[model samples]
Target: MRKLGTVLAALLVIMTAGWAGNAEAAKGIVIDGSTTVGPIAKSFAAYFMKKYKVPVTVSESGSGNGAKSLINGSCDIADMSRSMKPQEIAAAKARRINPVANVVALDCLAMIVHPSNPVRALTEAQIGDIFSGRINNWRQVGGPNFPIVVIQRESNSGTQETFKELVMKGRAVVSGAETQASNGAVKNRVSQTRGAIGFVGLGYLDASVKKIAVNGVIPSAATVKNKTYRLSRDLYMYTNGKPAGVVGTFIDLPKTPDGRRIIQELGFVPKY
Candidate 1:
C-alpha cells in the first residue's frame, strides 16, 4: 500500500512539472515574415523583451511563409510588407484562423544601383523595360557601357509581389535576372556588382548603394508619407484575430512615441 502511494505522488509531481514546462514554452510571442519588415520586427521585439522580460522569436522567411505559419497555428504575428492576398485569407478561413492586418509603418520601394553608376533617374517605362528583357545595356539608360545586371527578390517575397504590381505594372521580371531571397541580399548584390540595379525597402538603403529617382522624385520619408513617391506602400502585421494580451500590446507599440522613433530611425515612415 505504501509503495502504491509513493508511486502515485511521484506521478503527480511529474505531471505538475510537465504542465509548468508547457506553460513556460507558451509564454512568448513568435513573429515571422517579410525580410522587408524583419528589421522593424527585430527592433520591436528587442524593445518589448527588454521592457517586459518576455521571450520573443522573430524570423524572416518571407511573407507567404509567414501567412502559412499563422494559418497552421505556429506563429503569433505575421510581419508582412504587403497586405495579405485574397487566397491567403481564404486559406486561413478554411483553417478557422481569422487573419487580421495591423498597419505598422509606411515604406518606399527604392530603386538602387551601384554608387559608380552615373544614371540619376528613370521614367516608369524605362524602369519597366530594364526589369523585363527589353533593355539589356546600361548605356541605353545613359549609364556605363556594361550590361545591366537586374537583381530581384525571390517569388515568395512580398517585396517581389509589390514590385511586380507597382513597378513592373503586370510585366514579368526577365528570366535571366538574378533572384535573391531577401532585401539585404538584393542590396548587397547591387552594391557589389557594377551596373547592377535592384529595388529594396527604404529601410535597407545605405551609403553602399545609390537610390535613383523614379519619375524625377526621390524616395524619402517625406515623399513616402505625402504619397508623392510612386513606390510607396504600407507595411503590415497580421494576427489570428483582434490580438489580446502581449500580442495586442506589441502590435500597438507603433502608436507610442518610442515606437514611432524606432520606426523612423530604421528609415521607415511612422503612422503618425
Candidate 2:
C-alpha cells in the first residue's frame, strides 16, 4: 500500500508539471527592446491587458537586444526605434524566424539642450560638428560663453543609430561624450546640466530641456511629414514571423480607433 501511494504521488507531480507547462505556453505576449520605444509599448501592453484580460510583458534593454530576443524565440515581438539591419534579418532567417515588421509610430529624434542655453535652433551641420567634437563652445552657436558638454546615447540605442545615420552622416560619435542608456535619462542629464546637449525621441521632450530646431525646422508631425525634420524615423516592432495569438491581436489593435487614441495619448504619431 505504501509503495502504491508513492507511485500515485509521483504521477500526480508529473501531471501537474505538464499541465503548468501547457498553461504557460498559452500565456502572455512578450515584447523586448528599444528603451526609447518602451513607454509606448508599455502603454499598449497595459491597455491591451486590461481590455483583453491577457497577460503582456514589455522589456526595454536596447534595440539590438530586442532583435536578438526575436531571433532567439525568447519574445513575441521586438520594439525597435530603427529598422533591422541586414545581418539581423539574415540571422533571424537562419533561425527560421521570419521577422515581420509593423510600423507602429513615427518618431522625431529631437535634439535637446539645457533650457538656459539660449540656442533655440541648430542646423544639421552644427549638430554633426557638436557630436563630432568640432563645435566645443556654446558661444560659437549663439549661446552662453561656456564649453559644450556633449551627451550621447549608448551604442545599443536605436535612436543613436538613427541619429548617427541621419544627422552625423555616418561619422562616428565623438569620444568623451557622456553615454546614457535611455531617452529619459538623457533628457534628465541635459535638463540638470547647463551647456549640455543631448538627443531624444519627441515623446521625451519637456520643459526641463529645450528642443533645438533643426535647420530652421521644428520636430513636429507637420515638419516630419513634410520632410523638414531630418531626424525623423519610423518606429517599428518585429515579430518572429507573422505573430499569432495575443501578439497578433495586440498588433492589429493599433489599427482601431481606440488604439490610435492610445498611441496619440502616449505622445507618439499614430500609424492609423
The numbered model that scores best in lDDT is: 1
lDDT, candidate 1, at 211: 96
**Candidate 1 local Cα displacement, residue 41, angstroms:** 0.9
Clashing pairs in 2: 98-241
Largest TM-score belongs to which candidate?
1
Q: What tens-digit string does per-residue lDDT give for candidate 2 at 12-117?
A: 9999999997677558788999987788889888888789988788989999999999999998989999999999999999989899999887888999999888
TM-score of each: 0.91, 0.90
TM-score of 1: 0.91
lDDT string for model 1 (12-64, tens) is 99999999977885899999999989999999999999998888899999999
Give the poorly placed runs of model 1, Cα more than 4 Å off.
1-23
TM-score, cand. 2 vs. native: 0.90
- Each prediction's total of clashing residue pairs, residues at least 3 apart in sequence or on different chains, is 0, 1
Positional deviation of residue 21's Cα in model 1 after best superposition, in angstroms: 6.8
